[model samples]
Target: MNISNYIDYALLKPSATEHEIIELCHNAKENNFYSVCVNSSYVAVTKQLLVETDVKVCSVIGFPFGAMATKAKVYEAKLALENGADEIDMVINIGFLKSRNYVSVLRDISDVKSAIGDTPLKVTLEISELNKNEIIRACEICLDANANFIKTSTGFSKGGATLTAVKIIKKTIKNNAKIKASGGIRDYETAIKYIDAGADRIGTSSLIKSSTHAHQIRNTKIYRKYIETIQKTTDSAKPNNTIKEKEV
Candidate 1:
């Protein structure tokens, strides 16, 4: 599979400058990445840069941490959509989840999803902080709340996506939801492995690299491997021809 198909090609750095955001959006447009994920502060700039292109602008709400007040998260979502963001990646409240406050968790996600209307909502589960049971419950909660995707981590967590976590998430969600594996996916191989484990999208900071010859290469061999693995894992996970084939 082509590597680009599996990548979201992220640029969510807090210190990104206006020039960098502009260049990044242009690269995404030219390269056809699935989307360019940025902080909410850059949403307007990113939207402006991606004006007429098919490349989508994604902004994070409640961002690296999911401890913001419910109203804050809702307002953030509304503002992002108003600014032309095509998708919003919001972090789940791990604190509430661990406390068994399922109601709050569900309501938080639901409120934001509702606020966005038709825009896609990806809820970051931060899988590293939770156990298998918690991960399953989180996926279920996201599904119940009508979240569009169950993202693995915030990249600011203690650890990022794991093969085991991705597998469990896919099995628990059972294709009812898409999976996004973020953080620690630095090379082409790791990216492919996550996809193989059932990640529909990959979030990483590395996209372009200058090779020894000084030519820029959009290296995503790692991501390609992850996709191949995802194909295999997904095939085995499904019982029959009942499973829908994912687009490459």
Candidate 2:
């Protein structure tokens, strides 16, 4: 399976320097990974690096912690898009979700979605901070808010993506809201398991390949009901070839 299509080629480290960001974009360009998920500051450079390529630039909004004010998240998302971000991965307020104030969480996601317009929004649930019931409830709220994807973990928490958490998210989401299994994934082997377990995308940093557009995905086909905006998961629908690493 050419898993490169499923990978986001993540590099969300706080200590990442501008040089490293440039290198990250270079590496992403050299490989057919679906996108480069980076902090908002690097969106512009990454976008410039990835020009004329299918590899998209995904920016994190609200970031590892979702405690920022709703307006702040909206502004961040807007600015990221202005700087050339193709996707917005925003964190949900864990405290608000724990407080059973579901309305606030819903509005938080919806507000960002509105600000970004057609740029698909991924709601990071921080599955590590929530229990099964809470995860389900958070997924419901994201569904109500019309989020494009439900991501697991920020890799900043105690735990990262787990097959069990992916199962919970898969069971909870309505419509075609895709699932991005992020955090902890660093190899092709582990990433494969997440997809088999139902993840529509994989976020990682330690994986790479020689650049080739053989499996790159395009940004089209909105999967929403009333709103025809934002693209679907990076070619999640493409059939995985039986060709193995040895063959490649």
Candidate 3:
């Protein structure tokens, strides 16, 4: 329950090399950032690197874009798990969601969840493209699909997580599912503010830099409070077995 607890410290990049991934995973394991988020292709290597550590291997499915066929997403999820991914962060089909094709969205999430079984699923809602009402509805759809978490953005969007969006998502989910605020969160202050606004997880590429000096104190305080709140909420929501944390 410290600054370490709130960070999912992402390392997502389309151009990341194997050597970079190895180094990144090593550093992530050393620093004890909650988890290391990476592309599915590196799940095997990441698993190998994080072997004995508590740091999990979080792989993205359907990646920065979620327009893939549903079957492809399901296959991708299964493959990632088979390769040692502990969690799957999948982007929702924004096109489908915006069109109000709720059934397709629900099915997409449900299929991936079923493929992964107990492995946690964090469905990216791409908040920047969603209106307030759509954001609320997306949260409801995610919950109804039995998604474990609702994520804010893909970091490829026009904008990323916003305080207002996080608040609305929290209100819609109401602790039934957690929220992950990703994209454009570069500093400790911005990350802490999101946590205070009710984000259970933070996904940012600036993990190392953000953990520096003055802001560290604030980040620690906010993250600890977030974890404490999580413990209490999880205690009442379901059994410990059901509260697995997903990175990415």
Candidate 4:
């Protein structure tokens, strides 16, 4: 598996500098990553940097915390689209979901999806905050809201994506929507676990590592095994070989 094509190279840290974003775009272009996920403010610059490249620009809305008003989130999504973001990942209203106000939760997501039209919205459920049933319900709500993807985390949550969470999401989604497993996926082994558990995309910041660190990743047991498998087969469409690993 090349693995590079499924990645959404990300640099969403509040402290990320313009130089870092430039480096990120360069790395993504070099690796043929699927997209570069970033904060809304940097979308325009990222879009410009990745101009004429196959790499897409994705922006997050109501990140980390989803306590913002629905209108605010909608406005943010619109502004990001205007800034040239090709995809949107929005945090679901955790409070409303916990409050059992399904109507408001549905409205929050549907409104944003409505505003974005067909722009491919991925609703971040922040799975760390929810129980198994909650996770299933969130997947259903995302489907009703017409979200294109059900993301597992914002990577700033108390926990990151889990194998169990991905399984639950996959069971609930049943191909209705895709899954993006983000947070704490630090190595090729962990990334494969998520993919095996039914994740369509893996999101992490490890892919943006230094050259030395990148060498270490390439040498990891799972990565080496992947290389061996690639050399042994010409078929590239194997499910295991086609999953995405985004740099979040």
Candidate 5:
């Protein structure tokens, strides 16, 4: 399916060393993936490495968990943008969403959107924590807030992306926003199903692991951080799916 263009090559792991981050950016540029998603701390280096390439630099804000105050998130987003981040993937305040504080949730997303101003914000809903109605409401809020994408999970949570969830999300957004099916899409087949079901982008660490040249990384021992952890199944691993949890 040529998932390359639709992939947000991720490396959001706490244990990810500087060398691995550099290699991640270099490989992304060579593979022509849509973008390289990393924690905000590594955004600068990733951007610097991929400056001349077409790859976009995506930085996560209020990562893993989304309970940070709105002001803190805005500041974080601004700093990421200042550091050359082309995209911002922020976790939605799940606590607020679960508490039915839709207004706060919308405002949080809107404030960041306003700060970034067309940088393409992807709001991670952490779908596993919510019910069907909550997921739909979150989509509605994201659309209202003008978010560019509604990401399925953070991979650090209980579950990753699911086809049923994607379908439901697509049905909810109804072309207002795109769906980024993340969490656990390791192999080609699983990634394809998410695309077919309605995912616009596929976030996985499995690209390098599933590629014909996956062995190329073996000699370098570059796949150590995620040899068997983080991604539950080998079917849906993204480029840099690490289970390191950093709650805000």
Candidate 6:
């Protein structure tokens, strides 16, 4: 199959430089990837780099962690759109979901979706941090929030997407929302498995090293970050039940 069409070529590392982002856009263009996913700061540059191509620019909101305030996420998502992001991938408020504060979790996602208008919003569940029931609950919540896609992970977590998790998400969301299987997907074989399981998009940077375009970025050694050094503190915070209006 045409794996590139399903790929969201990503580079969300906080340390990613402009040069790296430029290379990412070019690589994506060369491979004709569905989109180039980057941090909000790089959306403008990525948009510019891929302006002459059909590749879309995707920006991450609240990034690898979903602990930010709803207003802040809204602002970031808007700015990313202004800067030319075609889609938004937002991390869900894991703490709120874990604390069983479903209201806050629902509001957090819906608020962002509301702000983005028609832009496709992908809600990241960070499945590795959740149980099967939590995964189902998160997918249901995302559907309630009008999320366009239910993303599996942030890749900075302890683990990435698993086929089991994808199947669960597929079963949970059904035809309501699409699925994006991200994290830990390192090769064509692994990526295809997620697609077969029901993922409409594959968010990964690993293919950069294994694809035919490897020669394009081999010397820069830029693919190292794609493997992702799991963030130890990503899920360490205790579930806080307080639903403050301000940034958490």
lDDT of each: 0.86, 0.86, 0.88, 0.88, 0.89, 0.90
lDDT of 1 by residue, 69-172 (tens): 98999998889888888999999999999999999999999999999888889999998899999999999999999998999999987998899999999999
Off by over 4 Å in 5: 208-248
Model 3 weakest lDDT span, ten residues long: 207-216
Number of backbone collisions per candidate: 14, 1, 0, 3, 16, 0
Error of 6 at 150 (Å): 0.4
Cα lDDT of model 5 by residue, 1-248, tens digit: 46788889999888998999988887887888999999999989888999888999999999989898999999999999999999999999999998899999999999999999989999999989989999999999999999999999999999999899999999999888999999988877787788899899989876633444444566456666566555556656446766788899
Using alpha carbons, what is the TM-score of model 2?
Answer: 0.83
Off by over 4 Å in 4: 208-248
lDDT of 2: 0.86
- Model 5 lDDT, full chain set: 0.89
Give the per-residue Cα lDDT of candidate 2 at 65: 94
In model 1, what is the error at residue 136, expressed in angstroms? 0.7
**lDDT comparison, 1 vs 5, better candidate:** 5
Question: Against the true structure, what is every candidate's RMSD?
Answer: 17.1, 16.1, 18.3, 14.6, 14.9, 18.6
Between which residue pairs do clashes occur in model 6? none
